[model samples]
Target: MNEYELKVFDEIEDWKRKITRRSGMMNRVSKKAQEKINEFIPEKVHELMTESIKGMVKATLFGSQLTTNRKQAIGLSLEERDELVRIKISSFQKTAIIEGAGTGAGGILLGLADFPLLLTIKMKFLFEAAAIYGFDTKEYEERLFLLHVFQLAFSSDEIRRNTLAVIENWEQRKKELVEMDWRKFQQEYRDYIDFVKMLQLVPGIGAFVGAYANNNLLKTLGETAMNAYRLRILQKAQ
Candidate 1:
C-alpha cells in the first residue's frame, strides 16, 4: 500500500476498535428504556412499522439497481476512488438535508413521509458508493453486503459487532447466508433512529432538527461504508 492507503488502513483499524467496543452506561440505559417502550407499543404498530420499512427497503434495493451505474470503476487508485466516494457522500448529504427540511416543515404528515424518503436516499448512496469502490451492486451478495454496512452504521453496539464480523469475513460468510432477517433489520434500524426522528415531528423546531439529524445520519453511514469497503480491499491485498 502507498502512503494514502496506509493512512486509510490506520483509520479502518481505529474504526474497527471503536465500533466493536462495548456501549457506555448511558447508551446501555437508553437501549433498555427503548426496549421497555417497545413492549408497550401495540403489536399491530410494531408489525406495521416492520412491514413498512421492509417494503420500502426492498423497493429501494431493486429500484437503485435499475438506476445505479452497473459498471464498476476501473484502474483507479484507492485514493482516487475514495475522493469520488467523498464527493458522492457530500452530494447525498445535501439531498437528505433538503428532503428532511422540507418534509419536517410540513409537520406530522410530511414528517411521516420522510421515513421512506430518507431510506431511499441512504440506500441509493450505498449503491453508488459500491460502484465507486469497484463493487458490483448487481450481485445479490453485494447488495446484501450493502445492507450489512447499513446495519453496522445504525444498530446497537452488540449488533454492530456481529455485523462487523460478517463484513470482515464476507467472502466466506456470504456463501453461508441466503437471506436477511428483515424483522431484526427493521427493528434495529427503527429503534436506533426513532428518538431523533420523533423529534423531527414536533411542530416548532421540526425542520431544524430534521436537517441536523439527517446530516449526521448520512455522515455516519458514509464513513461506515467507506471503511467497510476499505477493509475489504485492504484485506484482499494482504
Candidate 2:
C-alpha cells in the first residue's frame, strides 16, 4: 500500500475493532432503560411509526433523483476522493442542523416533520458519499451496502457486529440477501433515537435538543459511511 492508503488501513482496522467491541455495563444498562421506556408506548403507535419511517426511506430510495445518478469519480487517489466526501458530509451536517432547529422550534407539528426530513438528508448524503467513493448507488447491491452501513451506525452492539460482518463480506454474502426487512430497519433506527428525538417535541428546550441530536447523528453516519467504504476499497488495494 502507499503511505496514504496504509494510514487509512490502520484507521479502518481500529474502527473495526471499536464497532465490534463488547458493550460496557453502562451501555447495557442504558439499553435496558430505553427498552423499558419503549414498552410504555402502544404496539399500534410503534407500528405506525415503523410504517412512517419505512415510507420516507422508500421514497428517498426510489423517488429522489438527487445523488444516485452521480457518476463515480475516476483518476483520483483514495485520499483525494475522501476529501471530497468530507466536504459533502460537512455541507449535509449544516443542512441537518438548520432543519432540526427549525422543526424543533416550531413545536409538535413541525417537530414530527423532522423525522422524514432528516432521513432524506442522511440518505442523500450517503448516496453522494458512495458516489465520491466510486460506488454506484443506483445499483441494487450498492444501495444495500448503504443500508447495512446505516444499521451499523444506529443498532445495538450485537446487531452492529452482525451488520459489520455483512458489510465486510458483502461481495460473497449479498447473493444470500433477498430483501431487507423494512419493519426491522425502521424499528432498530427508531429505538436507537426514540428518547432524544422525543425531547425535540418538548415546549421549551426542543430546539436546542433537536439541533444537538441531529448534528451528532449526522456525524456518526458520516464516520460509519467513510469506514464502511474504506473496508471495500482497502480490500481491493490488498
By TM-score, who's the top model here?
1
Q: List the residue pairs that clash in candidate 1.
A: none
Error of 2 at 22 (Å): 3.8
lDDT tens string, model 1, 8-69? 99999999998888888877777788889889999899889878878889999999989988
Q: State every prediction's TM-score relative to the real structure.
A: 0.95, 0.91
RMSD of 1: 1.5
lDDT of 2 by residue, 45-150 (tens): 8889777777788789775445364765677789999898888888988999999999999999999899889998888888888888888777788888888888
In candidate 1, how many Å is residue 102 off? 0.9
Clash number for each model: 0, 0
Task: List ranges where model 2 is wrong by over 4 Å.
Answer: 23-27, 36-48, 66-69
